[model samples]
Target: MAKVIVLNKEDFEKLSEDVSPEYPFLKDNREIMSASPGGLFRCLMVRAEGEKENMLIAQRKDTLYLGYGRDYRSFDLQGVPVEHIALEEPKAYQEHAVFYHRPSHISDLNGQNPLRPVPERQTCFQVEQVVVLSDEQFRQFQENGLKDDQIFLFDYSDKMWFDPGSFCWHCVLVKGENSRDGILVDAEGYSYARYAAFAPDCDKLRLQDVPVHYEYPARAPEQKKTRKRKEPER
Candidate 1:
């Protein structure tokens, strides 16, 4: 069973520091760095099956990465080797949502804020669960067509790949009147929106013209449909 626990800034820091020895890779990881710069509260943490899987939601910085496969994907914290993970999911996570909160940079530049009562918009996606994908499992999905259910989230970080070049991971969900939203905890441990592409009457991915690529080898050819014998003979 997996447990989701919310930790305060202090507790989260202490826990992360304690665990750092066992998971040295986490020490300098961007997720942890961005989420808790100098021990600031940035995300939620998850542990599954007594250290079987440990995941966190790291915060993302502004100034998004544009273009196809801008960066590598996969968790170095996981057992998978960093190089292999990158090769498998070459594109960086790309489906990022732009937040419109009070500019922290501006606040820093100015000494004090006169707008005391003003509140910034909350830019958070309520996380429902974490989807852990391994290299072997991902390859299997490639051989077998990727089911809609298999995708927990869309290409927020674009790290989650379902297809190849046709849609690099950076594609965003199409805007629609009745689109449903889902939450995915990224490799960095941040929450991002995952729009349902298979929903009824929603050709979201197709509409976006997102390129599709498959890394695995293709299976046997599908049998073609043949027309029945002409009835004119009768």
Candidate 2:
């Protein structure tokens, strides 16, 4: 396993917009990042060990990304070494829906032996629980404006091999960071749920020539946007 590399803002910009082949950890698998409970961040590599597979850690500013693999693809992560936090808990205790982390660093919550968390590599805390909301509450949350459940929030943590079908993503979009273009990433269970995927931007990554609309999650199916005619203009 290689140590995480953190770069200053000025230094990061000097690197290539695309994946670098020079570094040992910048893999370019096109698979999008996962948002499921256990894998809240695939490229994030933030969870406890044994939780991630074939991934490397890198940081720019305050954001952490999983960008590693023996082989390179279309994109990946690269950087220099820095002291960062890595979670060592074998497991998180779950009660009902919330998952509680018992890191040894926190004496008050000590019972099981867990590794102490490092500071700017960022703190390690487990947050997994279903957010609840009544129909009215959900409506209020949407009152601000029209929104799409299938939104692509990219931040350049591209991993081409991650499959979202095994998880909770019904749809995944691998949009390029430099181009502002998009690619729809799908799997067997891709229509799994009405969810979102936060993928990284690849410099020369492939893009979808045609627009794709994942229509499974119906958008206001019962409502008609057309207005009824006024009795043929009276």
Candidate 3:
């Protein structure tokens, strides 16, 4: 668990200098400051291993939201019925929505397992497309489509186990640039915070398709008592 520290512009700049080599995005970008007041910023502490990554996004407004996860889903920016975002796969004419959710299997509250499953909630965000001038082919996004801000989803049920001092954990979207190889950004500090950006023109993109399942634990049986023993005692 990492402690939350509010950094002034100078502190943020200094911290950026310290970690910018590995995460070059923090080097010369003025836009990083856009995450102010209640805007989103990545935590510079935790790292995720291989496919099992974790990331954190934080906001400082009237309220706060956070999310952390490894695997993520993809979504279409232009589509009908917002529920379409939850669709299992991307459709050919229809746009798609994609993002990550903590798979439900581990959260099952029943079964003989002593580990109490954490409760997860559906947190949604709208994805919009932006052009990455650096890369002729790659597409960029504006955080969560806000004028200058982005939104994220989080599950705080296990704050006690992972981050006892914090109230919740969150995943956030950050502006990224396109490189010759792929979309790139300096997210090493918050690698645990998995990121999912909207894919434009669903033709080439593949969204993670997960089967939905629900489970309910069986109720405990009531105890039964025998009456024959009472007569012998008398």
Candidate 4:
């Protein structure tokens, strides 16, 4: 349930008005220009309206790719769609149409008649599920870890552990001696091991592929103050 604020050519021009030199407005042939409401991320959905087919954009951290629909579907449909780019990477818009091209219900509603105080929308890279490796399969996974481009979850249920904020371990296998290990890579591609034997601070693995439910950590309630009677009004 997300809506986009479509920016026409004339509206797109305004992006350059106060942008820093580091991030510049797009001037290329991309036809659709739109972004998540707050504009922290910009998504370009289609080519200049003449391309034979729509291109798919997927982001692996800061890197963006211009891919085809079929190729992504072939990968068990696990392709991470680049629905938008952080405003910091203005160059991302120039490379490809990174956003999905469909208008949502709210967008249609807005088209019918504009609304004040538009609703907020969220965009991010998503994976439907992560496959947990079997013992034998995990051994094989470690053997050709980096070679396998599929995403996976490691079994860390023994520790009763989960990411402090996320449900899944959400990692990629790496070349290593231990079959139980998985490496966590940050947005910038820096890698680290999440295995308890290796990095204790690292988050424990998830036994299954599931959505991470995010809830604010509980805090102690503030004690209300009571005023004593003013000593019989002094």
Which candidate wins on lDDT? 1
Q: What does the lDDT read for residue 46 in candidate 2?
A: 18
Among residues 3 or more apart in sequence or in different chains, the pairs in candidate 4 whose N, CA or C atoms overlap within 3 Å are none
Error of 3 at 118 (Å): 23
TM-score of 4: 0.17
Distance from true position, residue 16, model 4, in Å?
54
61-175: candidate 4 lDDT, tens digit per residue: 3343333332222333233233332233343221211111222222221223264223354122222222334445444533343233333222322222224464333232221
Worst 10 residues of 2 by lDDT: 95-104
Q: What clash count goes with each model?
A: 23, 11, 18, 0
Ranking by TM-score: 4, 1, 2, 3
TM-score of 3: 0.15
Greater-TM-score candidate between 3 and 4: 4
| Model 2: CA > 4 A from native | 1-171, 174-196, 200-234
| lDDT of all predictions | 0.30, 0.28, 0.26, 0.29
lDDT of 2 by residue, 129-204 (tens): 1122233432332232112222221211221123335422222332221223222232222221122221222222
Residue 217 lDDT in candidate 4: 31
lDDT of 4 at 41: 33
Task: Pick the winner on lDDT between candidates 3 and 4.
Answer: 4
User: Can you write out model 3's per-residue Cα lDDT over 1-234, one digit (the tens) per residue?
Assistant: 122223334443453334322222221122222234455453322222222333333333322224454432221223211110111121232122233221122112122234533234322332222212222212222221222111221121111111225422222222223222211111212322233323333333221231111111212234787676455654
| Model 4 misplacement above 4 A | 1-129, 149-180, 185-234
